[model samples]
Target: MNPAPDPELALEVLTDLVRTDLEACNRLIVERMQSPVALIPQLAAHLVAAGGKRIRPLLTLAAARLCGHRGQRHVALAACVEFIHTATLLHDDVVDESALRRGAPSANAVFGNKPSVLVGDFLFARAFQIMVADGSLRVLDILATASATIAEGEVLQLVTQNDTATTEEQYLQVIEGKTAALFAAATEVGAVVAERPQAEAEAMREYGHCLGVAFQLVDDALDYSASQAALGKTVGDDFREGKITLPVLLAFATADETERGFWRRVLEERDQSESDLDRAIGLMQARGTLQATITRAREYGARALEALSIFPDGAERRALAGIVEFCIARAR
Candidate 1:
């Protein structure tokens, strides 16, 4: 049997690779963002310097190396993918009116919405330029499709805001579009660049899809369950923003009709209060919905791991396989 996956092996494989491309990404971002007006460069650089996981591009590089690719272009492409993701985040924070990310003020909050949104558009344009320079029509196609899906997912979440009736299916679609599609695309492009067989390429794509889903599910779960110190944001940020995340969805189902009055007030009524959050948390815990939410995330994690068995055993493959647990249990 294959050996058990290394828990931190993903982090290990990512260490040097992420560092190298992060430097390149930083350079490229600065080079492309320069303008006659200095504010553009200044604001964009501030957020880029703010720091993030940069996991999107790291996934690309790791996936490519795992599939036996040796070309230097993968590094450039990975950085390009990260820029696209970062751009989206700048835009997202503005749209969500979120104040904090990774324990700091968001780009929109600091630079104001106009600069954040405009800079985001500039990044998107720069990403496309870099992607096309690869001269791979297939790469452009996948990235295009994934980008459109991301837009749709964001709109879906916006439309579904505070709608307690948001179904699991709807939630899945939103997550797939908004978060997982990019992950799937980034990893899939790695396999595609390596000229892996169609089946294996498809396997990597599915692995990314499932892994992205699990990652977002756990992120949503953490919003309700983790403390600000641990999560780097307040619990119930979802509720405050009228987001009906997985834990909230479960709580809606499991809460008694009487107790659900509290949910309705917090999620539905315009007059939501601080006490409403306390009551909702208590009711959700009492009904075990928070645990159920974690269980739901675990099931996705299992599926993500299942998709990885297709690749042959190696440190890279093992690390890829182990990432599911990290994504699912990241709250701890």
Candidate 2:
């Protein structure tokens, strides 16, 4: 059997493989985010500088390379992917009323919700500009549809929030729209830029879709199981928000009547106390819901690997596979 993959090492390998392209993408991100409004760039830069892993953009660059792309188009497109992602983050934080991001005060917290929303709009506009400059209606459609799907996903999450009866199918739909849509677009656009066959492009999209699902699943598990330092955000943020993630769903599935009442009071009623988060975690631990969530993530990760099998064996393919492992390893 393959040795267990290291999340940090897998991430580092993929980052190193696309180091130069990633640098160019970063520079482009800085340049495009600038505006005379001052606050636009300042607030935008705050989140950019806060520095998440840049996994989406990295996927774009790596996907292009894997498709044998030689042009510089992938760099600019990668930046576009990041702009779209950052824009979503800005909007999401406002919606979630999240105070912290990447271990720092979120933009909405620092700049206020109004500016955060507007800057997020500005970033979306910037992403469109990049897409237009690429002059490919196909790429534009892919990313634009993703943007809309993300909004729809967020809205769907709102509909399901505080409701313990959310089905796994509904949860999957929400995540597909909010999280996986852009991942699908990011990787698909690489193939488009490389002028690869449609079959290849679809394969990449499949890989990304599965990977995004896996990534978000692990994130949900970590919310209840990991430290703030390790998670890069507050633990129990989802619980506090009443978000019906997989772990919560799994726990609820097996909950006795008393435990069900506890979930309802905390999640549906939002009547949480200081001890509630601890109790929630304890219940999840006893139910092994966290591990069950991780197991679900691994299943999606396996599908992501299968999607990559269409491509030939090479460093790019391995790097992409490593990404799948990296995402799943977070829960372990």
Candidate 3:
């Protein structure tokens, strides 16, 4: 049998395959982030320099190449995707009151909430400028709708926070809106720039949607199980913030009254003690909820892989398939 796919290795391979385009995209991101107001660029640069996997923008570059795009339009569109993602991260840090992002102080922590929020708005406006410059109404519509959907998702998650009665379906809706919508838009716009047919664009959209769901599920599981270095943020952030994730929902579904009291006290009342996170993790482990969450992520990963079948056999397809492995393998 083939050796298990290594997610880091897979990511490196994808990065190498698109190294040139990725460089161009990075340059575009830097160019577009500059402004007359130094703080706008300074604060934005802090977050941008912190660096992420750039997975969403990578999807745009890879999907366009997979659809036979040879022009430079994908570079601009990829930059637009990154701007949108960065803007969201800036806003998220403020709203979540998160101290860290990607193993460093978050923009809000360094620049204060006011600067972070305004800079995030600046990035969003810059993204719109790029979209209009591209002159594709379809691209604009896809990204615009995604931005709105992401907001709706964040609001839905806010509504469900600290609510132990949050259903699995409700949790899925939250992720699909907040996370999957942008992933879908990122990939779909690739086909749009390439001028591919609607069916192909839909396939890419499906792939990204499934991948995004799997990505978030794995992230939620890692919050309780992974090391601080692996997680790139506080391990118990969700638990501390009373964010309802899949693992919590699964564990809560099988809890007795005594255990329910523990959850209510910690998650609902936010009356957490020092040992509460450990106890919460222990409950999830004994109940196998963490593993169950990973299993669910793998199911979505499978669907993401299936979505790529319509594309012919090639390195781009393989790299995209490996990305699915990369997202799910984080749970391992």
Off by over 4 Å in 2: 1-5
lDDT, candidate 3, 200-304, per-residue tens: 999999999999999999999999999999899988999999999999998899999999999999999999999999999999999999999999999999998
* Of candidates 2 and 1, the better by lDDT: 2
lDDT by residue for model 1 (1-332), tens: 23234544555555554466557655765687777878878877776677766677777877887888878667767767887787889889888888887777887888899988988888788789988888888888888899999999999998888788999889888999999999999999888888889887888888889889888887887887788866765667887887878778887877778767776777777468658777767777877777776787778777777777887777767667667776776755
Q: Is candidate 1 or candidate 2 better by TM-score?
A: 2
List residue ranges in candidate 1 displaced over 4 A. Answer: 1-13, 17-30
**Comparing candidate 1 with candidate 3, which one achieves the higher lDDT?**
3
Q: What local lDDT score does residue 96 receive in model 3, on the 0 to 100 scale?
A: 96
Q: Model 2's lDDT to the true fold? A: 0.92
Model 2, 1-332: lDDT tens digits are: 13126766988999999999999999999999999999999999999999989999999999999999999999999999999999999999999999999999999999999999999999999999988998999999999999999999999999999999999999999999999999999999988899999999999999999999999999999998888998888888999999999989999999999999999999999999999999999998999989998988999999888988888788888898998998888777
